[model samples]
Target: MSIPAIDLMTTLRSGHSTSPRLTWYGPDSERVELSGRVLDNWVAKTSNLLQDELDAEPGMRLGLALPAHWKSVIWALAAWQLGMETVLDGGDADYLVTDRPDSSGRHDAVIAVALPALAMRWPGELPAGSIDYASEVRSHGDVFMAHTDPSASVCAIRAHDGQQHLHEGLLTGFAAPHEDGVRLLVAAADGLEAALSNSLGAWSSGGSVLLAHPDVELTDKLLAAERIHGK
Candidate 1:
C-alpha cells in the first residue's frame, strides 16, 4: 500500500500564524520562544542546509543525537520537511546530528550543533568532516521546496534498549488530538519518546510546546508559569 504523505511544513504553516508555537527552557533558566512563522523559517533554513550542504534527500536516514533543545526540534522538523527519516538513537543513518564532544560518530557527514540558543560557534573542535550546524544552517536559503512527495514513513524512534518503531510522521505517532490551542509541557529525559510527544502533540494540534530540561527541578512551577495546559 502506498503511504499518503503529509508534509510537516505544510501542516505547520496552515496553523495559526501569529501565535506562539514553541518555547524552550534550559537547565540554567534560559528561555527562547518562536511563533509559527519563525519556527517555519528555522525549519526551512535547516532543511535547505541539509539538502544543499549535507546532501540530504528523501528516504535518507539522518541520525539525531542531540538533547531536547529547541534546535533539536528544529532539526527534526527540517528532516521531515526534506522527507528524510530521523533516527533517534544514533543507529543506521547516513548522517549524524550531535552536539556531543567527539561528534564524528559513524556517519560520513556529522552536523555538530551547539545547544546554546545564542552561541554562534561550536565550543569544541569537531573531528574532520564534521560541520557545525549553527554556523552552516543560517547561510542556506530560508525557504525549502521538496523535490518529491514525502513518504509516509517519517521517523524511526529507537529506544535505548534497542526497540524501534517507525511512524508515518512524528506527530501522527502519538494519540494526541490534533485540535487547536492544546499547549503541552514536557519534563522527561531527553529521548525520542519525550521529544516527539511534546513537540508533535502541540504542532499537530495548532498548539504550542513548553519544553523543560530534565534538570529543571520544579516541573509544576514551570508549567504554571508558562500557562501550559497539558503534560
Candidate 2:
C-alpha cells in the first residue's frame, strides 16, 4: 500500500483535523518549524497583542517589523485574522500586485502597495490606508465574510511547496479541478497579495513568512500558495 499525496487545503475543508499546522522561523544560520497548540496559544495571545498594539499605531496598515521568525509568521497571520491587511512584499515592503486588464481594453484594477524596497523618498510618504494601521489591519473576520459579495470558491492550505512542489505562491488563483487536482498559474500581483492576505489572516494557524535575503527567489513559494489553495 502507498500513502497518497494529500492536498492540505482540501483536507482542511473536509472536516478533517489531520491537515498539519506548521510554522517556519530562523536567522541567517538556523531555521526551524514549530507546531501544535503552543503555536496556537501563542497566536491567540498575540492576536489580542496586535489589537492592543494597533490601538496606538496610526493608519490601519501595520508592518511586521522583525526578522523572519516564528513570531513574525504568527503576527502576520494574526493581523489578518483580526481583519487587517497584511502585505508581503517580496523584497522591499511592497506586496506583489496582479496587473491584469479588465473586460475593456483599458486597465482598471489598482491596489495600494507598501514595498519597503520602493525606497520612499518623501516625509511620512510611506504608503498607507485612509485610516490608521489598526483600522486598516483590524476588522471583525465574521462580518468581513458576511459583507463580502459572493465570489468564486477559494481553497486554502499550508506547507504547500513541500508536497505540491509548488514554488512561491506565484501559481494560479487555485480552484478545485476535481476532488484530487487543482488549477493554477502565476496569479496577478494584487490577486496574489489579496488571496494570501485572506489565507494568512484566516487560517486556523496564521500563515508563515520565511524571511531571507530581500532578493531571495520567492517565486516558488508564491506559486506554492496556489497549490496549497487547493484545499
Give the Å shift of residue 68 in candidate 2.
Answer: 4.2
Error of 1 at 154 (Å): 6.8
lDDT for each residue of candidate 2 in 1-231, tens digit (9 for 90 to 100): 101111222223343233334423222333333333444444444445444433312113334334333444455444433433333432222211211111221211112222232223222432332222222322422111111221112112222332221112212322222222222222223233333433332332323223333333445664375344422
- Write the residue-wise lDDT of candidate 1 on 132-220 in tens digits: 88788778887787667666654445555554445563555442454567777766475655666567776766678777777776567
With candidate 2 superimposed using the best TM-score fit, by how many Å does residue 82's alpha carbon deviate from the native?
Answer: 0.6
Worst 10 residues of 1 by lDDT: 1-10
Model 1 score (lDDT) = 0.71
lDDT of all predictions, in order shown? 0.71, 0.31
- List runs of model 1 lying over 4 Å from the truth: 1-6, 101-105, 153-170, 174-180, 188-190, 219-222, 229-231
Clashing pairs in 1: none
Q: Which stretches of candidate 2 lie over 4 Å from their true place?
A: 1-20, 23-31, 56-59, 66-68, 88-231
